[model samples]
Target: MTAKLWIDSDVCMSSGRCVADLPRVFRFDDEEIAELVPDADIDAEFDAHRDLLVAAVRNCPAGAIHLQEDGVEVEA
Candidate 1:
């Protein structure tokens, strides 16, 4: 397991960049805003889509997404 990921909604621009990069890991709610799949455990899910997760973070213009490992910061 690597790290968990979280997106700060307050800083999110609703760009959907993360959603587009990782459709299986992200989604857009009815409001057309980006949202993580409920209860997602990114550390466990990392192996399958780490690339996409990284890509999402890289693509996010607001820089709202963050990754943490065992409660330690991994990405800002």
Candidate 2:
């Protein structure tokens, strides 16, 4: 199944990796912290690019990105 995604803004380091690597799923907020693109269909993205999403979560330097499936957090 598709996973749910979010970012912990407080922990975000503004590295821009996710935004640069997956613009369709992520973007920088006004303060420059990475966040999920508001209009993105997360389910569709998870279904289509699960590996990339997992990589994003794993690669986030600040460990700010999160993902869940069936309400259980997905570990990087």
Highest lDDT, which number? Answer: 2
The runs of at least 3 residues in candidate 2 whose Cα sits more than 4 Å from the true structure, single-residue gaps closed, are none
Which 10 consecutive positions of candidate 2 have the poorest summed lDDT? 67-76
lDDT of 1 by residue, 1-76 (tens): 6677877877888988788777766787787767788867676578776777777777789988887656776553
Global lDDT of each candidate: 0.75, 0.91
Best by TM-score: 2
Q: What is the lDDT of residue 70 in candidate 2?
A: 70
**Model 1: runs farther than 4 Å from truth?**
39-41
For every candidate structure, what is the RMSD over all alpha carbons to the true structure, in angstroms?
Answer: 2.1, 0.9
Candidate 1 has its poorest 10 consecutive residues by lDDT at 67-76
Give per-model TM-scores.
0.76, 0.94
**lDDT by residue for model 2 (1-76), tens:** 7578999999999999999889999999899989888999989988888888889999999999999977889886
